[model samples]
Target: MLYFCPASVRVRAASGAALKPIQSINAHPSNCICIKFDPTGKYFATGSADALVSLWDVEELVCVRCFSRLDWPVRTLSFSHDGKMLASASEDHFIDIAEVETGEKLWEVQCDSPTFTVAWHPKRPLLAYACDDKEGKYDNNREAGTVKLFGLPNDS
Candidate 1:
């Protein structure tokens, strides 16, 4: 069971047992924007308003890695189906993939529009990301969105 505390505080479980928290590490300057646990439940990643993404160990309860941003705040994060990669989306309108162990960015896709969400395929390596586009300068026309599929190359 993974949890996200906006202020980086460790939360107690519902069993009335207090879990020991490791030294607190601040991942983002602001509250966490989003968080997701890997399918295996071994680790979790956090997206933040400070434009950074952080990976934490579930068992150790300590942050293992942080990916800083240049200008955009990270809004969403997801792990690949196989848990080898991480995908992060931000207000910068781009989605980025990174190596889970090293926090090394592998690739990025620019949406050229505002993005709101990102998720991985349950059984495939494909990613589904959502973005919004305007039809006209004054058209405040916000329509239901779609998840644009982004493909990943074979790891081998």
Candidate 2:
């Protein structure tokens, strides 16, 4: 997998041996927060404080797509095992799932608290999400959270 550091958005490759730079693309000037790679290692995803997640074609070394208009900085992004969906979460308390090929938005879900993280279930059509939990006026304790379970609709 490859990653871009916060200070330097220069791309580098990391394997079992040593860190070798593959290439560098000026993604964002500052705050290159998070980076994710597709399972097959064909492409990569990058999220920045610029409120944008840019997709790159690793082989071609060109920018593929950019997703912006996020309510806040994009914190995380992940690709499904089959590489059909690209999931993104921001400090906006919402999640956007986009199609890998067409870059079309599959759906968006909202929660009260910001989605800190998300993972696709290993064996089922389910997603696990974690977020901050607020109790009451005197108590503002943060906690791990959950989202609604999504499954194929049943036909009668």
Candidate 3:
């Protein structure tokens, strides 16, 4: 398992009597806000306030790739169920989806407000995110919060 601290990512053995650190990586220059393991457990991704996302090899404990596109702090990250893509939500009102292997940006969309969270459907090509509407229109309505869903194009 992995633990994401302010500026580090620690790998721990989950089966041990006590979770002991196997390795630790100083992953980000600023606070690391989110970490997620891919579905296959072969790789993990970390998002930081320094406007960067890092992909790491689980066994090698080394960074395989770094994605630097966001101009604001990243708030959340989610990997597709197939583990081939990664999605990041940032405080700058944008969300980006990228190909995991090549760090190629698949697409990006701007939201009306800063996004707080993002998730990909476990069995489909649908992406969802929630935003914090500072305007208070959605919040005051007491309706469902500012949540949006997007359907991705077929890979073929």
Predicted structure with the largest lDDT when compared to the true one: 3
Order of candidate numbers by TM-score, starting with the best: 3, 2, 1
Task: Output the lDDT of residue 150, model 1.
Answer: 85
Q: Can you give the lDDT of residue 107 in candidate 3?
A: 81
Clashing pairs in 3: none
Collision count for each candidate, in order? 0, 0, 0
Model 3: CA > 4 A from native:
7-15, 134-144, 152-156
| Candidate 3 C-alpha lDDT tens digits along 5-92 | 5624433334356766665678876788888999988999988888898999988889999999898888899999899999998877
Please give the CA lDDT of all the candidate structures: 0.73, 0.72, 0.81
Better of 1 and 2 by lDDT: 1
Better of 1 and 2 by TM-score: 2
RMSD of 1: 4.1
Better of 1 and 3 by TM-score: 3
In model 1, which regions exceed 4 Å deviation? 7-27, 135-142, 152-156
Compared with the true structure, the alpha-carbon lDDT of candidate 3 equals 0.81
Q: List TM-score per model, in order.
A: 0.79, 0.80, 0.86
